[model samples]
Target: MDALEILFTASFWVAAIRIASPLIFATMGELICERAGVLNLGIEGIMTAGAFAGWFTVYAGGDLWTGVLVAALAGAMFGLLHATLTVPLGLSQHVVGIGVTLLATSLTYFIYRLALPEVTSPPKIEPFQPLPIPGLSKVPVLGEALFSQTPLTYLAFLTVAVVAWVLYRTPVGLAVRAAGENPSAVEAQGISVTAIRMGAVMVGSALMAVGGAFLTMSAFNSFFFEMINGRGWICIALVVFGSWRPGKALIGAILFAAFDAYQVRLQQMSGGIVPYQVFLMMPYALSILALILVARRATYPKALMIPYQKGER
Candidate 1:
C-alpha cells in the first residue's frame, strides 16, 4: 500500500532477480576474460549475437535448450575470433574488441533481415517458467523471492559459489589469475600463456553468450534490435565494482538490479511525479557513483592488456 510495503514485498524481489540474471551472467563472463588479462569490449556485441542466435533458433522450430546451446556456441566462436586476433596475432586488445563488437552487431542485424524479411512485428518464443523450491518457498518474504526463481536465476546464484571456489581453491583458477597479472612469469613456469589466454576467452565468451540467451529465452522471450542496450557495458563496470571476485560481482549486479526494479515500480506509483527516463537512468548513474567510491580501493591485474609472445618482455 505504501512505499515501504511495496519495497518489502516478495514480488518486487522476484522482479529484481529476473532483471539481474543477465547482468550476473555478463559480469562473470567479463570476469573470466579480465582474469586472463583480456578486456572484452566486444561484450555488447557478443550478447547481441547471442540474443539473435537464441531467438533465431527458437523461431526456426528448435527447442529452447537447443537455442541456448546455439547461443553459447555463437558466443564461443566470437571469443575464439577475439583470441585469435589478440593472442597469437598480437593485435591490440582494445582494437580487436571494438572490431568484434561492431562486426557481431552488423552481422546479427544482416542475418536477422535475411532470415525474416516480411515481419512487421517482432517474433516471440515461449520462455522458461519459474520453479519454486519445495521447503524454501515456504519461508516468508525470502522464500518465493529467492527460491521461486527461473532455472537460469538459480544457475546464476549457484555460479557465484562455484566460481569463488574455482578461483580461490583450484589450480586452473590460479593459472587464470596468473595469466593476467604476470604472463611472462607464468610463461617461465612452463605454461603456454597463449594457450591459457585462448582458453579463458573461449570459455568466458560462451558464458557471456548464455547471459545474452537468458535475456531472449527467459527475460523477455523475444528479440528486438539493440535489446542488449548498454547492459554489457554496465557489466564491465560491475566487474570493476566487484573487484573481479564472484561474490562481489554478484552483489554489485543485484544492487543495480534492485535500483532497476524499483525504478520501474516507482514510475507506476508516482503517477508522473518523476520522469520515467529519470528512473531508467538510476542504474547507470548509481554505477558511476559506485565506481567512483570504489575506484581507489580497487585492485586490478598487474600485466593486464599486455600481450605475451615467447621471449618478449
Candidate 2:
C-alpha cells in the first residue's frame, strides 16, 4: 500500500483508541467497585459532575491538569454520597443510583446555564495533544497506531495494568473480593468489609471522574449540556457484560467503543443514506444487546444492586 494509505489506516485505529479511552477507564472503575460487592449505578452522575467540574475549572483559568483534579474530587464527593446511602443507611442501590443521575444532570445544567449566559458562542479550551513515546513512534504503522496517542490513553493502559496487578496479585484485592462475596464472614475475620467497600467505591468514583474529565479536557475540549451523555451508564452495563472482572470489563469497554467508532464511520460512508438519528442509536442499541447477553449469561455480581447493612455484615 501507498504511504498515505498506510497512514490513513493507522490513523483510524488510533482514532478508535482515542474514542475508547474514557470508556475503558470508566469500565475498569466499575469493575473494581463491583468486585468489591458494590454496584455503583451512580457512575453516570459522578461522570457528569466531573465533566462540568472539569470544564468550569478550565473556563476559570485553570490548566487541563487542574481540571482533571477537580473532576476527580467531584467524583469522590458523589461517591461519598452513594456510599453513605447504600452502605451505612442501607438504602437500595438502585434508588441511590437513579437519584444521583437525576441530581447530577440537574446540577450540571443549572451551573452551566448560570456560568455561561451566552449560548450562541461558548468559549472553548485547547485539548491535549498526542504525546509519542521517545522511540516507539518510528516503528512503522503499528508504532504510530500505538504510540501516537494522548496522555489520557497512556494513562488508561497504565490504569488497566495497575488494576490488574492489584486485583490478582495483592492482599487488599483478596479483601475486596471477599467483601463482595461474603460480607459477614469477612467481617467476622475483622477485615472490615465496610471500610474496604468504601475505599473501593471512592477509588472507583475518582477513576470515573477522570474518564469524564478526559471527555472534556482531552477528547472534546468543550462541554455541552449532558456532555457525558450515557457513557457512564454504558460502563455500568459493561460491568455485567464483562462478568465483573477488570480485564474482561476493559475488553468489553473497548469492544463497545469500537462499535461506536465504526458506527460513526458507517454514517459518514452512507452520506446521509442512513438517517443520522439511526446512527446515533447504535451505542444504545449495542448497550441493550449487551444487557441481553448479560441476562442470558447471568454473570452479574452475586450481590450487585443490594444495600449492605453494617449489622448484617
Candidate 3:
C-alpha cells in the first residue's frame, strides 16, 4: 500500500489500542474481583481517585513515575476500604460501591480545586514517549503500527496473559473460582473465602488505579476534571462480554476501543456520514449488545453479587 493508504488504515487501529489500554487494564482488574464474588461498581470512583493522586504526584515532584506509584498506593487504599465495608460489615455491594464512587469523585474534585485554586494555571506533566522495538520498526506495514508503543501498552497485553494463567491454570485460580461460585463450599474445604475475596479486591483496585494514572501520566500528561469519563462502566461491560474470562475480555476491550477510535476517524473523514454524538455512543451501544449476549449465554457465576456470611450458604 502507498504511504497515504498506510497512514489512513493504521491511524484508526493505533487510536483503538490507545483508547482501549485503560479499559483493558481496568476490566482485567474487575474480572479478578468479580470472579471472587464481588461486583465492584466503585471502579469509576477508584479511577477518579487515582487520576487525582497521579496528577498531584507529578505536580508536586515533576516525575511521572512517582505519580504512578502514588496512584497505585491510593488505589490499594480504596480497595481496602471496599473490602472492609463489603466483607466484614456485610453492607450491600451496590450501595457500598456507589458510596465509594461518590467519595472518590468528591475527594478528587476537592483536592484538585484546593491545589490549583484557579483554572488559569492548571498543573501538567510531560507524557511518556513511545519506545519502538529494535529491528522490528523496519518491517513493512505492521512495524510502526504494532512495535511502536509505550511501555505500559506492552504491559497491558502482558497483564492479560498473566492474569489468564493465574485465573485458569493454577491452584489459586481454582480456589478463587470456587470462592466466587460457591463460597460456602470453598469454606467447607478449609479455604478462607473472605481472605481470597479481599486479596482480589486489593489487587484489582491497584490495577484500576494504574489505568487512571495512565491517563494523566502517559496518555495526556495532565489531569482534567472527570477525566475518566465513564471508562469504568465500560470495563464492567467488557468483563461481561468476555464472560468473565481474562483473555476474551481483553479482546472485547480492544473491540470497544476500536469503536471509539473509529468514531474519531469518522469525525475527521470528508463526508461526515456519521453524527459525532452517534459515533460517541457506539461503545456504550456495543456494550449493551454484549450484555444481551451474556444474558443469552447465562454463564454468570452462581454466587455472583451475593454477600457471603461466615456460616451461610
Candidate 4:
C-alpha cells in the first residue's frame, strides 16, 4: 500500500495504539512528578530496572500481574531514595536524578548477570493477549484499535483518565499542584509539602516502572538489554509536549506512536530504496518538531526541579 493510504488501515492504527500503551504510562508518571515540583531524571534507569524486574519475576514462575506489582514496588523504592535526597535534604535535582538512573541501571544489570550466570539467550514468558470488547470491537478501525488490546493497554488508557481526574478534581490533586506552583502556599494551608512531593514522586516512579513492565510483559514475550531503547527519555519529552496534562500527553503519545508505526510501513514500502536509518529517525524528528511547537506555549509548574523544604519561606 502507498504511504497516504496506510493511515486509514485498521492494522496500522492497531499497531500505533499498541506502541502507545507504554508511553502513556510513563508520560503520566513523569507528569505527576513534575506536577509535584520534582524532575525525575531517573526515569530511564527506573524503567530499565522495571523491565528486568517484571520479566525476571515472570521468568522465575510468577504470574504476569505479580511481575507488574514487583516492578511497581521496585520503582517506588528508587523514588523514595530520590525523594529523600532531593526533597528533604535539598540536594541538586539534576545530579541526584542522574545518579539514581546510573545506580538503578547498573544494579539491574548486575542482578540479571548474577541470576542467569551462563545463559546466552533470554528466556521467554507467555505474555498477555488482546481481548476485544464484544460490541465495540465490531465498529471498524477505531474499535479494533481501541477496544481490542491486551489488558495492560487498557490499563494504560485508564491510568491517563485516573491521573486527569486526580489532578483536576480531587483535594489531594490541589495540594500536589500547589506543591509545584507554590509550596509555601501549600504549607500555609497546613499541608506537609514534603509528604506531598515525596508521595507524588514515589507514585510517579511506580507508574514509570509499570510502563517498563509493559515492555517485557505485553509488547514482547522476552527481555533483552536496551529493549526500553530510550522510551523513558521520550516519555519525559512527551510530558513537556503535553504541557504536563494527562489528556494532552495521551494524544502526544498516540501521535508519536503513529509516526513510529507509519515509519516501519514506509520502510517496507521503500524496498531498501531509502536508508533504514531515516525511517528509524522519523518518529523522533517529528516528535521534536511537535515538541518545539507546543512547548513554547506550554506553562510549566513554577517550582519544578526546585527542592522544597518544610519551612523558611
Candidate 5:
C-alpha cells in the first residue's frame, strides 16, 4: 500500500498504542513525582531493573503476574534508594539519579549474565496475550486500536485518569501539589515534605519499572541489555512536553509513539527508498524539538530539584 495508507491503517494505530503504552506508564509515574517536586533521573535504571527482573522471573518458570509483581518490587527498591539519597540525605537529584541509572543498568547486566544460561541467545517466555473486550472488539478500526490490548495497556491508560483524579481531587493530592509548589506551606500544615516526597518517588519508580517490564514482557518477550534504549530519556523530555499533567503527558506519549510506529513501518515498507537512519532518529529528534518548544512555558513545582531541609525554609 501507499505511505499515507500505511500510516493511517488500523494496524498502524494498534502499533502506536502498543509502542506508547510503556512511555505512558513511565510518564504517568513521572507526573506523580514531578508534581511533588522531585525530579527522578533514575527512571532509566529503574526501568532496566524492572525489565530484567521480570524477564528473569518468567524465564525461571514463574507466572507472568508474579513476574510483574517482582518487577514492581524491584523498581520500588530502586525508588527507595533514590529517595534515601535525595529526600533524607538531600543529594543532587541529577547526580543521584544518574548514579542509580548507572548502577541499576550495569547491575542488571551483571545479574543477567551470572544468573541466566546461554547469555548469547536471549531466552523467551509466553508473553501476555491481548484481551480484546468482547463486543467492543467488533467495532471499527478504533475498537481494535483501543480495546484490543494486553491488560497492561488498559491499565496504563486507566492510570492517566486515576492520576488526574488523585492529583486534583483528593486530600493527599493537595498535599502532593503543596509539596511541589510550596513545601514551606506544607510544613506549615504540619505535613512532612520528606515523607510525601519519598512516597511519590517510590510510586513513580514502580510505574517506571513497569514500563521497563513492558519492554521485556509485552513489547518483545526476551531480555536485552539495550532494550530500554533511552526510552527513559525520551520520557524525561516528554515530561516537559506534557507540562506535568496526566492528560497532556498521555497525548505527548501517543504523539511520540505514533512517530516511532510510523518510523518502524516506513523503514520496512520503503525498503531502502528512505534513509533508515532518519527513520530511526525520528522519535528522539521529535522529543528534542518538543522539549525545546515546551520548556519555555512549562510550569514546574516551585521546589523541584531543590533539597528540602526541615528547619531551613
Candidate 6:
C-alpha cells in the first residue's frame, strides 16, 4: 500500500491502537505524578521491573490479572522509595529519580537472573486475548481499532476517563492539583501536601507498572530485556505533549503510535531502497515536533518538581 492509502486501512489503525495501549497507560501515570507536583524519571526502570515482575508471576503459576497486580505492587514499592526521598527528605528530584531508575532496573535484572538460573530462553505465559465488543466491533475501522482489543487496552482508555474525572470533577482531585500548584494554600486548607504528592507518585507508578505489564501480558507473551525500549521515556514526553491532561495525552499516544505504525509500513513499501534507521526514527522525530508545538502553550503546574515542605511556605 502507498503511504496515503495506508492511513485509510483498518489494519493500520488496529496496529496503531495496539501500539498506543501501553503508552497510554504510562503517559497517564506520568500525568498523575506531574499533576501532583513530582517528576518521575524512574519510569523507564519501573516499566522494566514491571515487565519482569508481571511476566515472572504468570510464568511461576499465577493468573494473568494477579500478575498485573504484582507488577503494580512492585512499582508502588519503588514509587514509595522515590517519594520518601524526594517528598519528605527534599532531595533533588532529578538525582533521586535517576537513582530510583538505576536501582529498580538493577534489582529487576538480579531477580530475573536468580529466578531463571539455567534457562536459555525467556519463559512464556498465556497472555490476555482480545475481546471484541458485540455491536461496536463491527463499526468499520473505528470499531476494529478501538473495541476489539485486549481488556487491558480498554482499561487504558478507562484510566484516561477516570483520571480526567478525578482531576477535574472530584474533591480529592482538587487537593492533588492544589498540592502541585499551591502547597501553601493546600496547607491552609489543612491538607497534607506530602501525603498527596506521595500518594500521587505511588498511584502513578502503579499505572506505569500496569503499562509495562501490558507489554508482556498482552502485546507479547514473553518477557525479554530491553522490551520496553524507551517507551517509558516516550511517555514522559507524551505527558508534556498533552499538556498534562489525560485526554490530550491519550491523543498524543495514538498520534505517536500512528507514526510508529506508519513507519513500519513505509519500511515494507521501501523494500531495500531506503536505510532502515531513517524509518525507525520517524515516530520519535514526529513526536518531538509535536511536543515542541504543544509545550509552548502548555501551562505547567506552579510547583511541579518543587519540593513542598509543610508549614515552610
Model 1 error, position 108 (Å): 0.9
**Please, what are the lDDT tens digits per residue for candidate 4 over residues 174-220?**
99999999999999999999999999999999999999999999999
Best by lDDT: 4
lDDT for position 178 in model 4: 93
Q: Regarding TM-score, does 2 or 5 come out ahead?
A: 5
What tens-digit string does per-residue lDDT give for candidate 1 at 1-313? 6877877998998898889999998899999899998888889999999999987899899988898889989999999999999988889999999999999999999999998899978888888788999999879877878898888788888877877888789988888899999998888888998998999888888888889989988888888998999899899999999999899999999988988888888889989978888988888888888889889999988767888888998
Q: Score each candidate by Cα lDDT.
A: 0.89, 0.81, 0.82, 0.92, 0.90, 0.91
The TM-score values for the models, in the order shown, are 0.97, 0.92, 0.93, 0.98, 0.97, 0.98
Among residues 3 or more apart in sequence or in different chains, the pairs in candidate 6 whose N, CA or C atoms overlap within 3 Å are none
* Deviation from native of the Cα of residue 7 in model 6, angstroms: 1.0
**Can you list the residue pairs that collide in candidate 1?**
none
Model 3: residue 88 alpha-carbon error in angstroms: 1.9
Cα distance off (Å), candidate 1, residue 24: 0.6
Q: Where does candidate 3 stray beyond 4 Å?
A: 1-8, 270-274
In the range 125-161, model 2's lDDT, one tens digit per residue, is 8878889988997776668767988888899989998
Give the per-residue Cα lDDT of candidate 1 at 243.
94
What is the lDDT ranking, best to worst? 4, 6, 5, 1, 3, 2
**Which scores better on lDDT, 1 or 5?**
5
TM-score attained by model 4:
0.98
**Model 5 error, position 130 (Å):** 0.8
Off by over 4 Å in 4: none
lDDT of 6 by residue, 30-145 (tens): 89999999999999999999989999999999999999999999999999999999999989989998999899889998999998899899978899999999999999999989
Error of 1 at 119 (Å): 0.7
Could you tell me the lDDT of residue 149 within candidate 5? Answer: 88
lDDT of 3 by residue, 22-109 (tens): 8888998899999998888889989988888987887887576777779888988899999889876778889999998898889888
User: Which of 1 and 4 is the better model by lDDT?
Assistant: 4
What lDDT score goes with residue 279 in model 3? 70
